[model samples]
Target: MESSFQSENENSFNIYLKDISKFKPLKREEEHDLIIHVKKGDKAAMKKLIEANLRFVVSVASNYRNQGMPLADLVNEGNIGLIRSAKRFDETKNFKFISYAVWWIRQAILQAMSEQSRIMKLPLNRVSTIHNVGKVVSKLEQKLKRFPTCDEIAKHLKIDEGDVREAFAIGSGHSSLDSPFSNEDDGSLLDLIENEQAPSPDDKIDGYFLGNEIEDLLNTLKRREAEVLRLYYGIDCERSHTLEEIAAKYNLTRERIRQIKERAIKRLKHPSRNTSLRKFHQG
Candidate 1:
């Protein structure tokens, strides 16, 4: 199945004849003309314009490869940004398309990075802070011989002291000791630290297993009893309904539904001892 899917994808790619030979840097005049064509709803012109700018997308996408995402995925996301830019590209705005599109491209890539980082299960804001803090720390360390102080880092990054501390704490906590918090790392300081254990896998109560168990348990019930269980736990029943709701569904009084529910619960909780089955008392 996977091989068939790959073959289909390859065939589809072959249909789109990508002429990389005509690909040159889009000059200001060329970009302006393409914008005019795009505004006039010429999709072919837009495609050509985008193709010419694929190098720019690649250049921007390459910067984000360090964030532990596939470069191909980033480029694909950047292409999405490029398309959005073409769609929203306004000539009236004094900005050049390249200039306007750069921000859009970065936004698209960063947003994707944000989502990818969330697989770690950190909060959105915290993940964003981690990236921003790393960038700030890297730049500051490059200029200064030693690591910058927290106050200096905060002031330089234009973020609050609390946020800086939080970012640093999260970064340190997330990172291995071998990983430098800043670009500059003293061997002595690095040696004192130890890598924390990776988080344990989350425990999820398997819904499929629970559902199957419920189905098997329901099979032990009579037809009416099974229907009652289905109504209480299946599509028709969203909540733990009151006897009044169940009674209304079954066209009976609340008292009648109550009696049925109680009987069903008792039978399910404590089966009768007979030739076919054994009694199992439930707490």
Candidate 2:
């Protein structure tokens, strides 16, 4: 029965791949027309736009396979981003739709990986920063013909050297815990490991529930305020952002970003708000 189920799943996946491959990419003019139709609530145009971009999502998701997520799952998350981009796309923009869609696809894929890939979750901001650090290193390597040092990367990003090192460490690929310790048929690494200090399974479960509750509470804030809080606290992501970084992204001054963040925190702490997450709050 298991073998039969596996075969059926494989067949289904293969059919999906075949369907996506059948979608021809849109030409520039055709893409513009589709965007217009989509803005006017044309479901057919939206479907076409999504179909034409499924291959692009696959391409982007492929780069993230090393992060331990299956390719199919990454592609699925990327598709969600593609649909979101289609809904929010500005037709008046000078750039191509694919270019705009790339950011959305990547953001979705990274967010998924941050939330689901590891037993210990990292913030999405840290995941994104690690990706940026890698890009910088690759660019510098091509220019200098050698791998750049952490200091060089820090200098380029205008951040501390320790941050660059930490990003590199966090971005390192994962290894199987059950893998053999050495070539000689010896014991696996899992046999020699110690996790006494790790969180208890029950604690982890409670934290997971609390995380969901916090997400619900965050929905009470306005969109921009929620975004500010998310970025500032690394609520759903791997790392928090500095006020300056948030300010630059939103085209606001650092002080203004700080004020917005504070206001959002106040809303979260207000007694009138939901009380379910009140116990999770720390002084």
Candidate 3:
């Protein structure tokens, strides 16, 4: 039964590949029309748009194969992004659909990878921010002919020094705990480290108490501000959303969304408003 299942999977994958290959990519005019139809809720147009872009999704997904996820899974995630792009595509913008869709595609794939590939999963916004920081670092390195310092990178990226440091720390890939210590025949690194499973009883009590405290604090803000902060931080949701996404949901511009978020953060950071949350600011 296992052998038969494997054979069937291989055949299915081959068929999918063949179908994608037959879907010649849409030209600019053709894409515009299909996008119009998609906006009008045409299922056939939506399907065709996605099918025509499956190969593009595959191409993009291939770039992430080394991130410890299967190529097929990455492509599946990319296809989800592609479908989202189809629904959100703005023909009035006059930009190519592929150009707009690429961001969505990469975002979905990276979100999936961050959740699946790590035992210590970082928030989706942090993962995205780290990738953005890396891109800035690479460009700066090419221009300056050396590795950039945290302060320099922070200045270039227009983010805080602490944020840059955190990004670098989290983006550093994990290593096996069983790896040898140096080139010597000494015991593995795992032998030197102690593993702690669940949180302590005191810690659990503190965490529960703090969670209620934070939720109460969140209620102090206006409804829109509170919702924006919760969604941005994923305080109660599965994942944080990008500013652009929040902007779309609110029917506002990205800049407007950023302004609202910044204002919300400022309100939260006010000493009088968040006096009980002082521990959050302490190291």
Best candidate, TM-score-wise? 2
For residues 34-146, write the lDDT of model 1, one tens digit per residue.
88999899998899888987777878888878677767678788888788778666565433465556645765676566556553888878878777876777678558844
Model 3 clash pairs are none
List candidate 1 stretches off by more than 4 Å.
Answer: 1-22, 119-283
lDDT of 2 by residue, 1-283 (tens): 9999868876876788898999987777788899999999999999999999899899888888867777788889999989977976666643457756765677678767765654257777787777778789768966874446667889998888878766744553211212232234343322222222332232112133333444767788899988986776445454445566679999999899878866765665565564444343220
Best by lDDT: 2
- Give lDDT tens digits, candidate 3, residues 71-100: 778889999978967876656642357755
Q: For candidate 1, list the clashing residue pairs, or say none.
A: none
**Candidate 2 accuracy as lDDT:** 0.66
- On a 0 to 100 scale, what is the lDDT of residue 253 in model 2? 99
Q: What shift in Å separates residue 214 of candidate 2 from its native position after superposition?
A: 33
C-alpha lDDT of all candidate models, in order: 0.57, 0.66, 0.64
Which ranking of candidates, highest TM-score first?
Answer: 2, 3, 1
TM-score of 1: 0.37
TM-score of each: 0.37, 0.44, 0.43
* Model 1 residue 183 CA deviation in Å: 43
